[model samples]
Target chain A: EAEVAQSPRYKITEKSQAVAFWCDPISGHATLYWYRQILGQGPELLVQFQDESVVDDSQLPKDRFSAERLKGVDSTLKIQPAELGDSAMYLCASSSRGTGYGEQFFGPGTRLTVL
Target chain B: AQSVAQPEDQVNVAEGNPLTVKCTYSVSGNPYLFWYVQYPNRGLQFLLKYITGDNLVKGSYGFEAEFNKSQTSFHLKKPSALVSDSALYFCAVRDKGGAGGGNKLTFGTGTQLKVEL
Candidate 1:
């Protein structure tokens, strides 16, 4: 079975520092997602990508967070000037595009801690 | 707005016993409901989904969920619980009205299931 790939499984950064996480979704999957999972909370969507285009970034904090999926094969989520509240497990997921009921495949996630 | 709720924070069940995790969703238009499981230190894994069809939806690892549209509920079930099934479970939903909902999923808080011997 193909799996979603994520790198830098853990990161510790000081507040006000910049950090980035990477994800490579399964091949042929056209929809990619970035989510933040705070402790004891479910994953919250930060952005969604269709092919190489961003479909949604409504919940993403534009002032500090940015995401890109150039070429649509993989994606990167970056946060500049990280805040303490930004500490959480960053997860990446992907699924077949244009399906009403497609299953989403998830990556192991990168745990970010801001001091 | 679309949202999902897992009423129970935790559920304890003995091995070999049946188990059920409750989930309720609120969304406009037709809703696509989903169930996912997360093990310790791991990301969420897809379990099942209910789109348009019979209310009962079967998924991976002997898990199933029943979608009750009138009540706005989709409850996950397992006939025989195993220690391996112990994990955090989440319920999710997507609203058809939302733009490009085909890509985004809204998840519930989550329910931790502990199966004891």
Candidate 2:
């Protein structure tokens, strides 16, 4: 079974530092999603991309966070001047298009910790 | 807004016993519900989904969920539990309304299931 890929399974950074995480969705999957999972909570959507175009980013904290998928195959999420509250498990997921009921495949996720 | 709720924060069960995790949802139009499991340091693993199908949906790891439309609930259940089944579980929903509504999923807080020997 094809799976979504993520890099830097774990990262530790001090406050005010910059950090970035990468993800590669399954081949042929057109919708990609970025989510943040806090301890003891479910994953929260940060951004959604549909073939290189952003579909939704209502929950994203734009002042410090940025995300991009230039070619639509892979994506990167960055935080400039990371804050302590930014510490969480960053997960990436992908699914086929035209079907909202399709199952989503999730990446292992990059756990970020800010000191 | 679409939302999911896992009423129980934690559920404890002995090995070989049946387990159930409660989930309720609110959506504007038809509801697309999903259940996922998360182990320590791992990502969310898809367990099952309910979308215009039989009320009872079976999924991986000997798990199943019953979608109750009248009650607006989709509860995850396993006939028999194992130690390996212990993990954090989440419920999510996608509401069909406008473009934004069906494009993204809203998740619940999550429920921790512990299967003890």
* Clash pairs for candidate 1: none
State the C-alpha lDDT per candidate. Answer: 0.91, 0.91
Model 2 misplaced regions, further than 4 Å: B98-101
Per-residue lDDT over B1-117 for candidate 2, one digit per residue giving the tens place of the 0 to 100 score: 888999999999999999999999988878989999999988889998888869999999999999999999999999999999999999998756534436577889999999999
The residue ranges of model 1 lying beyond 4 angstroms of the native Cα positions read none
Worst lDDT 10-window in candidate 1 chain A: A95-104
TM-score of chain A of each: 0.97, 0.97
What is the DockQ of the complex in model 1?
0.70
Q: What are the per-residue Cα lDDT tens digits for candidate 1 across A2-55?
A: 999998999999999999999999999999989999999999989988899887
Model 2's CAPRI class? Answer: medium
